[model samples]
Target: MFELTAALIVFLFPLAYSPGPGNMFFAANGARFGFAATLPASVGYHVATLLVTLAIGFGFETTLQRSPILFQVIKWAGSAYVLYLAWKLFRAHAIDKVGEARPAGMWGGAVLLLLNPKAYVIIALMFSQFLEVAASSGEVIAVGWISSVFTLNNLVAFTVWTLVGGQIAGLFRDEAQAHLLNRVFGSVLALVALWMMFG
Candidate 1:
């Protein structure tokens, strides 16, 4: 149990907080919209995260391992969807005021997490690293506890990124500055999508 707790903090922290498609999307949304408007999507994303973590901890990883082609299909589909999001961000016009831009809704957030290849990989890794085989009771407890910790950590990391985006938006008072920021974030998202496809 101690080992599992330590692993969750040591491994999951970097995994959840590091720059990735989900985090980047939240940041972009925060910059485009505002923190208040981004809550629904954030909630949806974290809920999906919890579900995925539980699924993997409960043995979904074996199913995924047996079907490599299925994983590939998911990777490609998710990459394509992320590319579409990047295109939207790239083409978005700067709003005169914050929170005026249309934000991705709860459904979009759910879909993003459902198809996110990185999320799958991270959950699988967490379970593989932390779950024990000898004790069923301990395993059950660890699953629940670890899943909760992962979900909570994810919520915090994403919210921080969102707030960072909001701060960036606040800084870019001029239309041209905001426009440039959007283009940069959009390009970064596109690159992340490409990495998902080939990396």
Candidate 2:
């Protein structure tokens, strides 16, 4: 139990804190919407991630590690989505134009997770690492526990990011700065999407 806990904490801390598409989105949204407004999206993003990651941990990761074609297909798919999101964001209206209003809620967060490449990669790597670690103990329970820890920690980490984003929201009082922030974030998302697809 101790080993599993330690391993999970170690793996997830770096994984969650590292810059990724999801984190970037959180930052962007936070800057635009405020942390409280982004909470639902943050929660949704983690939940959706939990679903996809569990799937990967149990099945998809191993399959992809084995099949080059399958791996490439998913990679390309992820990349394509990122590019699509980028185009959409590039076209999205600037954030500052709104009259002291928050954007739409958690649904947007869910959508962002579904579109995020960094989320996928984080899951894939965790799956692989946990599987490797679990080999020594020959225990499925350890795997389950570790996965749960990772999931919970992921939620916490994302929430923290959203809070940071919310803090950023306070920095810009005008529409122009907000719009610039949005475009920058959008560009970053597109770049991440490209990495997911082709890299």
lDDT of 2 at 135: 62
Q: How close is candidate 1 to the true structure, as a TM-score?
A: 0.92
Q: Work out the TM-score per prediction.
A: 0.92, 0.77
Top candidate (lDDT): 1
- Note each model's CA RMSD in angstroms: 2.1, 3.4
Clash totals for all candidate models:
0, 1
**lDDT string, candidate 1, 66-185, tens digits:** 999989988999999999999988877774554535788888888888888878898887777667631465767778888888889889999999999999888876888888888988
Error of 1 at 52 (Å): 1.1
lDDT of 2 by residue, 10-124 (tens): 8688767876766666776676667777778777766776677667766766675688776566566656765665665555555656554455356766666665555666777
| CA deviation > 4 Å runs, candidate 1 | 1-3, 97-101, 133-137
Superposed model 2: Cα runs more than 4 Å off = 65-67, 92-96, 99-121, 132-140
